[model samples]
Target: MTHVSTRPLEQSEFDIWQQAIARQFADAQVAAGLWTEEEALDRAVEANRTLLPDGLDTRHMILLRGVLADGTPIGRLWIGLTHPRGVAGCAYLYDIEVDPGFRGRGLGRALLAAAEATARDHGATHLELNVFGDNPTAIGLYSTAGFEVVTQQMRKRLS
Candidate 1:
């Protein structure tokens, strides 16, 4: 396994990350009964648009690609700083995905470490994210990476 490197997301990689993020959200929404597949897809697309990185603000949002020794992109991690007040900042772990072929290779952990480093560099005091209850694998990964569940969003169908 090669060391994962972090870099600012390029325009060319935006669509790929966007699609991956949309898929993640869509899956979660469907599992949570918040939306049907079609509805979830639509909402994910919109959310992707809203979260697209902007360069104007000093708010740093980075997308990191984890590459194999030969440089094949096996995973991706991203972070967005929501607030930066003095030396303390708040950030969201926007996306973290390991390609199907790359699972079980510890690349996910590597990507997370990179994200944490990025957060520290940006003066972030805490990093946060929402994980679906169904995604135990992700929950475990996040837990191991030093995230605690501050709150859980529960839903009941009114229909």
Candidate 2:
């Protein structure tokens, strides 16, 4: 497995990271049938703004950038150290991404491990994430990483 070093996101990287996250999230929502193509980006932008009001310094939020040993950037990870009700020892993974060119090299799994370690360092005993059903690759990665399904939702179109 390739080794990836993690570091706090730099100020200069914020715009690119935010744009990538917004676009990817909007695309995911559209693919999951949860949002219309025309509205997905706008909705994603608003949601991100609300979730990250303090940007890179959002309370209880961890935003990390992954790079290779030689300092080549690979991806990013976003995690919330606390749940909505102030649940103890719980962390929520909001997002993880590897540059398309870097996929399939175990970087995703590496990022997951990093995320877990980071959460644990912050006193998290459990980590949770939501992966859209359309993303089977992520589902498989999370499953292989010992994550079990806590809940699932199903829907059908009558059209």
Candidate 3:
């Protein structure tokens, strides 16, 4: 694995990151059957905006961009305290992704490590995240990273 590092997301990169994250999240929701194609984008945008009310300056939010030793962007991570003032000692991983072109290079695991460190620095004793049931790769990654399933939701579609 290459030496992957994380840095604060630059202001100039926010728009591109926001757009891509929203689109990817929307697609995932649609794939999981939790959203419709027509409304997914709107919902995604609103949900993100709601969580990131101050964008990069949002309280308790930690947004970082992962890069290789050469400074090439490979991925991004978003994490935050689950409660105000760190009362819960828990952090929620809102998002993490490796660029399609950069996948399978172990960057994802590096980003996860970065997230854990950042969350810990912010007073989080535990970290949690929600992955869609359809994302087996993410599930496997988290599982192998020592994450366990706390609960699950199941659905059966009928036509």
| TM-score (C-alpha) between model 3 and the true structure | 0.92
TM-score of each: 0.81, 0.94, 0.92
Return the lDDT, model 2, position 139: 94
Q: Where is model 3 poorest over a 10-residue stretch in terms of lDDT?
A: 79-88
Instruction: Please give the distance, in angstroms, between residue 106's alpha carbon in candidate 2 and its true position after superposition.
Output: 1.0
Question: Top model by TM-score, which number?
Answer: 2
Estimate, for each residue in 40-95, the C-alpha lDDT of model 3 and write its tens digit. Answer: 99999999999899999988788889998899999888888774344478898988
Worst ten-residue run, lDDT, model 1? 52-61
List residue ranges in candidate 3 displaced over 4 A.
Answer: 83-87
RMSD (Å) of each candidate, 1 decimal:
3.5, 1.3, 2.1
lDDT of each residue in 14-65, candidate 1, tens digit only: 6666777788788888888888987898898887666664532224667677
TM-score of 2: 0.94
Candidate 2 lDDT by residue in tens digits, 1-159 = 788879999978987889988999999999999899999999999999999999999998999998899999899999999875566788999988898999999999988898999999998999999999988899999999999998899999899
Clashes of each: 0, 0, 0
What's the best-to-worst order under TM-score?
2, 3, 1
RMSD of 2: 1.3
